[model samples]
Target: MVSQLDNPNLNLIPKPSHTVKGLIHIFTTAHRNFFTDVMAQALRIAGQGTPVLVVQFLKGGIRQGYKNPTQLSQKLDWIRCDLPRCIDTPHLDDSETASLRDLWEYTQKVVTEDRYSLVVLDELSLAINFGLIPEIEVLEFLAKRPPHIDVIFTGSETPKSILDMADQITEIRRSHTP
Candidate 1:
């Protein structure tokens, strides 16, 4: 498969090498380590002294799947919105509310402020699908978002508008081979 980074259109915040820096979409129906894979790349970038922020909107109870090295303290920021399960929390209503707020606030800050080098919005597609966040709003945000900051969106379903606007897209699928 061709890497998204290989896409010529992805030159938004062109590196010295000329690469895009906004809206990376990774979708998958397979139960795989897509988040882990992306986080690993974020870690690598952070290692180089670039700021990285990762926010996971799902409340799966799994905390940051990666270790936070002290050396990268100021370089990396990771957060997850995994709400606990309980009868009172039917369908994660609380989580949905909390994440919607968090994503809105943080995402706005990231795009408008240009504080981080890379911002990974894990499971953001889920938020969009759940109607917690509007796709058009995000698209508008991206259009106005600083060109120097790179952002990523990961989940199973991707809207056509997003696909058309993105600089790169990587789709993950489960292997059926026995």
Candidate 2:
């Protein structure tokens, strides 16, 4: 009456012994699947009250097709909050700006209050392109996060500065010209 879970031949990846205090991981396409798997595991741990935050840097038009691997959408009950994407830009009128500001303020309040077990920032680099904040500034913000918080940064072509700050670096490279 033995089960697969009790099989001695199985090799189970070790989980974090205790809740993660602080961790920073940088990964590229060559290691995308491994990185994704690790993130999924961390999210599972975070769901058990580890205080997790995920900041994904997707190229413009990329994230629209992606789905949350951890089922965080259901776990966090996240609602989309649109920002101005710029201040006084010709495209957005004062009314639009005001609305965007209000949305931004509301979202920040929810995040700071820990309303969700996880917060997903999809395609944040696209917003960075709008000059909302410098890439390094975001990294600094992440580094200064409270020890109880578990922050995950995911992107394709991450800035070198941010990558340097990461504790774990996984580079997934594919040969393009062979």
Candidate 3:
């Protein structure tokens, strides 16, 4: 048989176009202070001129709402619930509940608008576990979000469904020193 390398039509083959698709990343830890790495990543990406949105579902006390996002840079926006204090338990007052619902709705709206390259949902798992946000809604949101937008979920005790859906999972464990 003749060598295939001698074929003259090899150069005429059309190359297939490849598109870049974003991935779902999950960062989990048993402690609350394990998100420094995630924050650093968000800042780094924003510093590189890519749009990033960080939403703190359970963090509050600053009265920062969706409309009053703190702009860390030209490309980064951080938003928190409009509560008077941080959420540590499932029980919430009517006003606090309303605030969280509003924030969740706003997050879905802006994420659907395809305005950011990376979106970080901080303490989202905790919110879900607390029943503040519906897990079904979150799954639906993930399904309907733009395919090119990368999403990062940070919290402890992440749901199995969300963990299974993640393309990459990072678990941080602290080593106790005696």
- Which candidate ranks first by TM-score, i.e. highest? 3
Question: What's the number of clashes in each of the models?
Answer: 5, 3, 0
Alpha-carbon runs more than 4 Å astray in model 2 = 1-20, 30-39, 54-121, 129-132, 173-178
Model 2 clash count equals 3
Best by lDDT: 3
Candidate 3 per-residue lDDT over residues 101-145, each given as its tens digit = 999999999989999989999999999999999999999999999
Cα deviation in Å at residue 73, candidate 3? 0.6
lDDT of 1 by residue, 75-122 (tens): 878765534421122244664576446646765776588778788777
Q: TM per model?
A: 0.71, 0.47, 0.89
Per-residue lDDT of model 2, residues 1-178, tens digit only = 8755666645576767876565565545523344456457656756676544443332212221122222353343322323323232325556544543444345345555655444445434344555544666566566555544444454455666776776776655666655
Better of 1 and 2 by TM-score: 1
The local lDDT score (0 to 100) that residue 71 gets in candidate 2 is 39
Model 3 lDDT-worst window of ten: 1-10
lDDT of 2 at 17: 80
Candidate 2 RMSD computed on C-alpha atoms after optimal superposition onto the true structure = 9.9
